[model samples]
Target: MPTFTALTTLADGEKARALAESMEEMDPTPDGVGVFEMEDGSGLWEVGGYFTEAPDEVALSLLAAAYGARPFAVSELPDTDWVAKVRRELVPVQAGRFFVYGSHDADKVPEDCVPLLIEAAMAFGTGHHGTTLGCLRALDRLMNAGIEARNVADIGCGTAVLAMAAAHVWPRPVLASDIDPVAVEVAEANAAVNGLSEKVICVEAAGFDHPTLAAAAPFDLVFANILKGPLIDLAPSMAESTAKGGHVILSGLLVEQAEEVIAVYSAAGYSLAHREDIVDWSTLTMRRE
Candidate 1:
């Protein structure tokens, strides 16, 4: 069966959400509708829907016009085994001391590296993306510097790879949280796959809001590989959650956005210790004063 997708973008989030809500009433209703803020600092929101049957272009055009959005770009997507395609295309990624691979590539893991098994699926962060890779390398750098953390948290953890990495090195229970329930589920599953289920606890929460995260406050280290806006919003909570002289490794930022993020964290009493630029993304390591 073929699937169809209709996408449009608008400047206003409220308008975008309204369009997404209205999509539910259309003929040949969408199987799923989503409204998301674009991460490029453009302040635009994207409204998209997936349909089992081809969506009505007239309806989409009318909705776009009503919302002052760009004309919907509708596309037909052939039914393909995306997971299988991902497995074939995603080779093992080595970042510092961490070796991330899917089960299919298990034979490639080196004896000296810390192996993290993350299947290529719906969740993000498999250590292939520069953001995830940079965080792993930053963690490795801390380990190499003789820094030992007994308590750790991975906020916005996608696959819990970083949390597992910390657990692998320190043998301590690490808290991993994500706003998306699916990501949290994936994180927990990945932890189990990596045999770090006991060492890494997964939770679904936005930033540090959950009771699990709050109870485990003043963490010795925290890894947040989320974007600049959330990273900035998380500065105060991160500062409060981190122990004095504790470390925080952050990524999911464009190279140009790093300075603003650095400034925010600096104002929150953190000093930049190290920075790595992997392609267009920048990863930062900072210490709480």
Candidate 2:
């Protein structure tokens, strides 16, 4: 497959969603931006966000229409070389002591992470975003605190990044869940790569929806890295699945969005523990009181 990106200077507005849904046929936007890649030879198109100062409708639509005028040049990838390119493009990053690497980058990742290489094609939590980094750091804090959790859940598992981190952080059994099946597949592969297949369970479900999550009873720790709206909506699920005195780590919200998310948990008897800010994103560690 060849990917071409389209750049659009559509500032923060309702137009953003409209522009995104317009290109739904092409490919789903990645990283929650106006960015979309051509799944086939269609070529990559990234709507590079325009400056907020972009001119009125006439100019905006003109640029938007013009991008499609030129042939999107698609790059050819050799089947054998795909792994090498993904690793080079999305370099493995280390947050605190946790490491994020592509399945192909397993050999390149520092030995400390126990190296879990999720396949290159896997989307979502590829470990490139601040949300993933923030989550890793938050997970590390739990390990550093010496909190022992026999049961853990990583909701919205997104490539099972947090679940893989949890397996490395503790000897406990961790259950990973994501609404996307591809994420589940990659997560399962990652678990095996990290030598944690036996310790971590990957499921195709949403926010602890699987029977294993239910069978495990209330978990000692839970990790959720979904957006503010979904996070708030699923607050009850997380609260219910967490043991009375266990803990929950929340991420994937902006600094301004944290208060509302925190409010949801705080009302449910979770007392805040530590707050980590990476870029403008925030992740909070809270314990069930």
Candidate 3:
């Protein structure tokens, strides 16, 4: 079956989110909608929707106009084996000592690096994106610094690649949680494929809301690769959940927004330990003291 996509851009995050929400109520509603900050540092937010059927161009245009966004660009995607295409195109990504690959590239995994099998699917964090890559590199730096984390949590973990990477080095269970249940399932599958099902526990929760996460309080290390808004909002909770002298790795924000995030975390009792900028994304490692 053919698929369709409609995309628009606006300067305001609120409008972009509102426009994406409105796409959900449209006739021939989208299978999914997303609002993401453009990494170009244009202060633009992209709102996009995907549909199994052709989306209503007129409705999309109207929504864009209402939201003060650019005209919606709608396209009909060619019918093809998207999964196979992804598998063929997404080569294994290496960050520091970690290697992220799909089942298709299983043979390409290096014996010297930590291998994390993340099948090309609906979830995020395959380590190809700059955000995930930066996070992995930051984690590797921490490991190289002789930091040992007995307890770890990966909040908003998509494929749980980061959690699995930590599990590969630390002899402890790594808690991985995501707001989306589908992501949680993907994380579990990825962990199983990486032979880390026992070490990387997956759960569905927003930030640190789950009882399982709450019970495992004061994590030695935490990974939050979510967006800037959620990261800022999570500062206080992150500080509370992190043990003294623990570490937090944050990403999914543009490089330009790093200072703002740092300031917020600083107020929450976190001091920046390391910062790595890859392309347009910035990954921050903060120490709780």
Q: Top model by TM-score, which number?
A: 1
Q: Lowest summed-lDDT stretch of 10 residues in model 3? A: 116-125
Candidates sorted by lDDT, descending order? Answer: 1, 3, 2
lDDT of 3 by residue, 28-132 (tens): 989999988876668899999999998989888889889999999899999999787887788999999998888888899999998888887643678989999
For residues 8-101, write the lDDT of model 2, one tens digit per residue. 5333334445555554433233322354332222333344432222223344354456444332222232335655556568777777787666
TM-score each candidate: 0.95, 0.70, 0.90
Q: For candidate 2, which ten residues in a row score worst on lDDT? A: 48-57
- Which portions of model 2 miss their true places by more than 4 Å? 1-85, 103-114
* Per-residue alpha-carbon lDDT of candidate 1 for residues 1-289, written as tens digits (9 for 90 to 100): 8999999999998888899999999999999999887878788999999999999999999999998999999999989988999999889999988999988898999999999888877436888899999999999999999999999999999889999999999977999999988889888899887888888999999999999999989998999999888899999999999999999999999998999999999999999999999999999999999
Q: Evaluate residue 106 in candidate 2 and report its C-alpha lDDT on the 0 to 100 scale.
A: 62
* The best candidate in terms of lDDT: 1
lDDT of 1 at 127: 85
